[model samples]
Target: AQSVTQLDSHVSVSEGTPVLLRCNYSSSYSPSLFWYVQHPNKGLQLLLKYTSAATLVKGINGFEAEFKKSETSFHLTKPSAHMSDAAEYFCVVSGSAGQFYFGTGTSLTVIP
Candidate 1:
């Protein structure tokens, strides 16, 4: 069975500070990983993705994630946080069988 786990339910950061959201996963084979962000009552948007092409994947809004195969982790990071960065982030994993697994989600709060 494949599953995704977001280590933190909520992460609060001051504006201009660095942001980090932890995530881990379990899969039988190499999986496709993605990070998505959703605002209040808004649709989900793709932040980044790891498709076995690169270990370090960069996305919009200065977001990036490193895929650690040995550790089964794909942790999201941002150099600086902005007030608009506040949103719900989800770590998703898709296996070879075409099954998608979504994490519980991590809410990011930007403190001004």
Candidate 2:
């Protein structure tokens, strides 16, 4: 079984402050994790992925996350938040084949 739960459905942060998004997952096999950002009226883009690779993965737009198997979590973090970072993020869990499952989705609001 493979599943993921985002601790928050929405996160609000100031334009210059750091951003944190929590996610937890359960998988029977070694999981393939991904974080995708979706802007309004736009498609989803791959932020990063963990395919039994490095534990700490750096992504685009100053975003990064660490895969903790013991904690069963993969939390996203950013040094500073930007207005462009305001978007919907989905925590994806994919196994063999092209199967993809998305999280409930997190809406990030960047305040000025």
Model 1: per-residue Cα lDDT over 1-112, one tens digit each: 7999999999999999999999999998888999999999999999999978789999999999999999999999999999999999999999787878999999999999
Sliding window of 10 residues with minimal summed lDDT for model 1: 92-101
Error of 1 at 46 (Å): 0.5
TM values, all candidates: 0.97, 0.95
lDDT tens digits, residue span 14-104, model 2: 9999999999998888889999999999999999888676899999998998999999999999999999999999999985676887889
Q: In model 1, state the lDDT of residue 72.
A: 95
RMSD to truth, every model: 0.7, 1.0
The lDDT values for all models are 0.96, 0.92
In model 2, what is the error at residue 77, expressed in angstroms?
0.7
For model 2, give the 10-residue run with minimal summed lDDT.
94-103
- Give candidate 1 regions above 4 Å deviation: none
